[model samples]
Target: MSHSEQTIEREIVSKGLTAPRLTPTSIDEAIKDEHYWVAPGRRLTVCALTLRNGFIVTGESAATSSENFDEDLGRKIARDNAREKIWQLEGYLLRQRLHDA
Candidate 1:
């Protein structure tokens, strides 16, 4: 097919790797609904896990104050933040699992 089509196919296959062993209910749940918080006037929440392998996997739908992010800047920001949080959580889980072992 076209170069873009091939690129998309490769991307899809590459993402199939690093699949988690256990699919926890919350693993696919939205970060915001999972954890709620208030920041005085503004509130923030996580809606997905950003994988180190460069995959944006969502356990639940994302929430945003903006009506539309056509430029996708909001998506990029959310993905970055979620990825950081997911990485941190993964580290914590790994340590805990090892400790339990």
Candidate 2:
């Protein structure tokens, strides 16, 4: 990857790592839907935790809005984004597991 691509990738991972963990937080399904307001009007973060076959998985979203900001919409969008990230992570993890197997 090019320098810019690497930077972008790092940013993405950083966002996931730095996202605020909601109440009852854990790697497991102890928490279902957790929302965190990262910035007053700039961004909102959310996460979902689940367990599958004794494995824990998490999904996160960092939603961004500039004009016409709405908290409800922002939260919804953030959750959707997090779910997308979770799917990507799941695929990557599955691939790694297969390779290691």
The sequence of per-residue lDDT tens digits that candidate 1 reaches over residues 38-69 is 22323233345544444554332233553432
Give the TM-score of each candidate. Answer: 0.34, 0.41
lDDT per model, in order? 0.44, 0.48
CA lDDT of 94 in candidate 1?
66
Name the best candidate (by TM-score): 2
| lDDT minimum window of 10 residues, candidate 2 | 22-31
Stretches > 4 Å off in candidate 1:
1-70
**Model 2: CA > 4 A from native:** 1-33, 41-67
lDDT of 2: 0.48
* Residue pairs of candidate 2 with colliding backbone atoms: 60-82
lDDT of 1: 0.44
Q: CA RMSD for every model?
A: 10.2, 12.7
Candidate 2 lDDT at 37 equals: 60
- Worst window of 10 by summed lDDT in candidate 1: 33-42
